[model samples]
Target: MPQAFPIFPLLSYDSRKNSMTEARNWADKKTLGGRGHFDLQSSPASLVLDSVRAGDEGLYRCRVDFKKSPTRNARTNLTVIIPPHAPTILTKEEGQPVWTMVGPYNEGESLTLTCQVDGGKPTPRVVWLMNGEVVDEKSETQGPQRVTNTLTLEKLTRSHLHAALVCQASNNNHSTPVQTIINIEMNCEFYVGFSCLKDNKRGMDKF
Candidate 1:
């Protein structure tokens, strides 16, 4: 959980204290046999990588075949995520969505909209927008999962048909804000017309 005491310029470690010329990799492989220079207690035996860099990552494993009992093996995943850079958002329609079937029914409805982002240092930022407004929630990346956010709206109406909803993903990696636009519409005449009409009526009554 904590960053293994990183003193860089030093990584090899040992359990015993002896006057030896610090060694890097152990040839034994079985136990990475303690050489003369193995750092004793100076650093952690196994490095705890909170976040890995791009260079060397992915699954790292070690296998041991002892002459006595059972064999042993272990693996660890090292993934690199670079933060996306804050890029320009031109007109908010650069990477906008283009609906299929050329229909308007899909425009309004109860919906759960979400956005997913990948690659970033210190993690990319993901935010949801409803009717061009921002929604609040903690943004975190689980494992190699790209940043993602979901916005849920219940019972849709015509006003939300062709409404401008946005999902913004940003980090230091990209030079522009990545946005995905959602244009929702309800196709059912009974649902859109009757429901939307009554919903608006309630608003007027409130005043």
Candidate 2:
């Protein structure tokens, strides 16, 4: 006479119950309706995920039960990394807010600007660059999602006129850094008959 074997359903670890719970009785499509991202099959006994998001990052445990064999369990830790949004440049002139362009500032005047970005799984880092060289970078976390960096150029001179000031932000190396560019404009001076004439330098914005 042959002995009978009882069938068992596949299960998932339930943290609340501290035990295994049946997960759709091993491949019941209707049980997983509305969650199109999950795929559980019998042949390979694997779970697939699609279009993952930051909210899906966490610890997961799967348990498999068999009719005539020992149970199997697996654990996984998922981490989702999201890129940051484009940085924005902001400043003020004479107590008024300014964006993109900061001035027709007089020569030897001080200039200050702030770069800000929001949204990323890991907080983004903001930096300031001038002429392809890093000039200043001071970052602060306003909360879990926002980041800001400020740069100040004290005593702007004729050499700083039309210079490209770049504000860049990035949280990961896999993606290109988001950046904003602004140009520094200053008063230009000319000599005519021993008299110094001053005029505002004007042109297209530099990258």
lDDT of each: 0.51, 0.71
Q: State each candidate's clash count.
A: 25, 0
lDDT of 2 by residue, 1-207 (tens): 532221432223233333334433334334333233333345655566556566556666666557568978667776888988888777744434355666888888898887878887689889999989998878999898899888888988899988989889988888888888888878977666654445547544433
Query: Against the true structure, candidate 2 has what lDDT?
Result: 0.71
Cα RMSD of predicted structure 1: 14.7
Angstrom error of the Cα, residue 143, model 1: value is 1.9
lDDT of 1 by residue, 1-207 (tens): 643432332223332343345433443322222222333455533544333346545555544444466866566766665656332222222334343211244434456544556666656778867666786444657556466565666666666656776667776553666766655555755433333233475565321
Measured with C-alpha atoms, the lDDT of residue 140 in candidate 2 is: 94
How do all models score by TM-score? 0.40, 0.67
